[model samples]
Target: MNLFADMRAVVISALDQMVADGALPEGLDFANVAVEPPRDAAHGDMATNAAMVLAKPAKLKPRDIADALASKLMDDARVALADVAGPGFLNLRLETGVWAGVVQAALEQGSGFGRSDMGAGRKVNVEYVSANPTGPLHVGHTRGAVFGDALASLLDYAGYDVTREYYINDGGAQVDVLARSVYLRYLEAHGQEVAFEDGTYPGDYLVAVGEALKDKVGDAYVDTGEQVWLEEVRDFSTDAMMDLIRADLAALGVEMDVFYSEKSLYGTGQIEAAIADLKGKDLIYRGTLEPPKGKVPEDWEPREQMLFRSTAHGDDVDRPIQKSDGAWTYFAPDIAYHYDKISRGFDELIDVFGADHGGYVKRMKAAVSALSDGRVPVDIKLTQLVRLFKDCAPFKMSKRAGTFVTLRDVVDLVGSDVTRFVMLTRKQDAPLDFDFTKVLEQSKDNPVFYVQYAHARVCSVLRKAQAEGWDMSDAALAQVDVSGNTHEAELKLAAKLAEWPRLVEIAARTNEPHRIAFYLYELAGELHALWNRGNELPELRFMQDTAEASAPKIALARATAIVISAGLGILGVAPAEEMR
Candidate 1:
């Protein structure tokens, strides 16, 4: 059903024939040979660099190889035209029936039209929104949550066995601070006034956690110091905070396959095992790290520590795994976590980190490389900051989360669909402005609305056709003669639809889900363009003068909806049937 892939197969088969005829060398590498859509749509349906790529290896001139390739390609009925463009680039135009077949394929496939087997069912763990378990998730985590969830779903569509995961940051000092903050609230719940200080959380979200703690133990910890209750309170508060985080994620329709506790790596010999493995490979050693390259920390001092030879893998410098005080550094637990992932037999690991964690990327990648002996590749995707705006003014901080807007706050303002779609309108590593005013507008400027409207428009066509007593089932459309849809605008839309499978493979290979959103927007635009064209040309409308003529046009519109629904499904957005 993938016309592009089919055409590439055609190109490859033709090249094999060329080798048989001795027009090209037998052993020339065809790995670099590619058939993709021409940059300019006017050029042709697809453009291949087969000639340009093999010319040097075949010891032939560019034009000479291209001419031979073109003749071989034109021998097939599907290749309507194959012209040699500049520098031996071969642009191909397919027969109109090819596009008609694509429209029928989409109807037959429904939402599965563009699904790919690019990943070949490889196990991939996508860990994201591992925000500290000290508070509810905030705006930064919102982008990460959306991006990770979408990417996981995208990989699934591309035939990867995806596991959505979250790494709970409960083993860090932040949770200790959360414990102290909750203790103050517990006192307040007992009618004793307390102030939230510099080293504690002050968000009102913890007020209920404190009350719940008092309900559980009554007055047991009322007269005790940190020694008697620090661990108990830390565990209790972390559970409450994790509950809050889960609810926040649920509000946005995200569910995780695993909630990996960082605390689980502590005192369990997991950290020791991971580091010991590295040590056995001569990767771990006690050494002194060099001073900061630029501005050193105010508390920076040279100290002998346990270091990992991360530079050997690809990092700029070796990284510390343990400090002189015998405490494992933050990177140590992360290494253990990834080692656990590799041990679990995942073929790949993908971590969705906030932009602030950019500095940790190379070292983490190096650790995974060393841990799996380069067998497992870890792809770290950094989601940039999200700036929220309302009515042209910056959105205020949430009273619940204290200093920043919480995920619940964003989800509540605009429903989860809008929030998720708007978050993906920009690349994960680029800053996004989520303007409440702009996103809700019913215009082309709002991509979620525009794309959803396209799906709804197709539904409208279905409803009207049904009301006219015309059979509008996909099977009926599939049986019709859609080759009659040779209109230039109709052909253009089918051309775009043909790119869906190609785009899915590219996005999955690159681990970028935003590309799906961008593609959907472009497809929706093309659908809207054809809809607009129908205003002046009655024959171009989906509702033609006769049911026989209308079936083919309806087939095209339904096909567009099918792809949009599939794309939106990958993005975790519910395709709209009717715009409310």
Candidate 2:
């Protein structure tokens, strides 16, 4: 059903015919030959670089190869013309029936229209939103959550077996700090006034956790020192915080298939085993790291420590796995976690991290490479900061002011669909501006609203057609004769619809879910444009005065809706039937 792929096959067959006829040399590699939408739509329906790529390899002139390829290509019923231009680019104008066939295919496939089997069912583990289990997720984690969830869905649509995962950072020193913070809250619950100092969390979110602890064990650690309550309180508080985080993610429509605990890597022999696997390959050693360039820490002193030879695999230098005090460094657990992922037999691994973790990307990749012996590839995507604005001014959140925006706050303001869609409107590696005023605006400038409006518009068309006694069921729509619809605007929409399956494959291959958001915007733009064109041109209108004509035209409009719904489904956004 992919028109471009179909046309590419025709182009390849023609090239093979040329080789047989002695119009071109034998055994020219066609891997670089690509058939894609022409840069200018006015040029043609599709364009191929076959002549240009094979000219030098075949020792033939560009125009000569293009002429021979064009003649052979024109023999296909689908191809109307294959014109050579600019040294060997072959621009093709496909028959109107080809575009109509695309619309018919969309209507026939329904939600499965754009599903691709490019991944061949490879297992992929996507770990994201692994924020420190110290507090409720904030705005920073929101972007990662949305991006990761959408990516998992996108890969699934592209036929990858995806596992959405969250790695809890409970084994770090930050959890101990959370423990002390909850102890203060516990004292407050016992009617004792306590001030939150420099090292403890002061957010009111933990107030309930403190009260719950008191309820569970009344007066047990009333005035005890850190020794008696630290360990127990740490475990209790981390569980509470993780609950809060899980609720926050649920509010944003994110559900993880697994919640991996960092603490689990500590008591088990997992860390030792992971490092031992690397050591067997001579990748682990006691080494001194060079001081970071440009701005060294004031306490800069070289120390020999247990390190991973990350430089052997693409990192800038070997990274420390253990501190001088014979304790595991932060990198140790992460390495062990990835090793665990590799052991789980995933064919590939993807990690979505915040932009601040950019420095850790290389080392993590190195660890996975060493663990899997380069058998599996790890792709780390960094989601940059999201700047919020209100009243056309920058909105700042301050932890000290007790006004920091949580993920719940954003979802509550705009709902999960808007929040998720808006978060993905920008590339993960690029900074995004989430303007409260702009996102909710009903105009076409708002992508979420615009895409939703296209779906809703299609619903309006169906309702109108049904009220007029025109059969508009899925089965009836699939039987419509789209052959009568040949308007340039209508064909343009069908052409855009043809790109959906290709878009899914590209987005999944690049491990980018933002591309789906971008593609949806473009598709919505085409749909809206065609709808607007109908206002000016009577022939382009969907609802005809007669049932026979209306069924065919409205069928195309319904086909647009089908593709939009499929695309939105991949983004995990519910397609709107009507927009308020």
Clashing pairs in 2: none
Q: Candidate 1: where are CA atoms >4 Å away?
A: 295-299
Least well predicted 10-residue stretch by lDDT in candidate 1: 395-404
| TM-scores for all predictions | 0.98, 0.97
Q: After superposition on all CA atoms, how large is the RMSD of candidate 2?
A: 1.5
lDDT of 2 by residue, 1-580 (tens): 7677777888888988888988887878999898998999999988999888888989989889898889988899988999999888889998888877888888888888888888899999999999999888889899999999999999999899999999999998899999999999999999999999867988898889999999999999998888999999999999999998999998988999999999999978999998899899999899888899999999999999998999999999899999999999989988899999998999999999999999999999888988998999999999999899986799775552154678888888889999999999989999999999999999988999999999999999898987887788878888888887888788888888888887888898898888988988998999899889989998888887888878888888888899888878877799999988
Q: Which consecutive 10 residues in model 2 have the weakest lDDT in total?
A: 395-404
Give one digit per residue, the lDDT tens place, for model 1 in 362-382.
999999999999999999999
**Count of backbone collisions within predicted model 2:** 0
lDDT of each: 0.92, 0.89
> Number of clashing residue pairs in every model?
0, 0
True-vs-predicted CA distance for residue 269, candidate 1, Å:
0.9
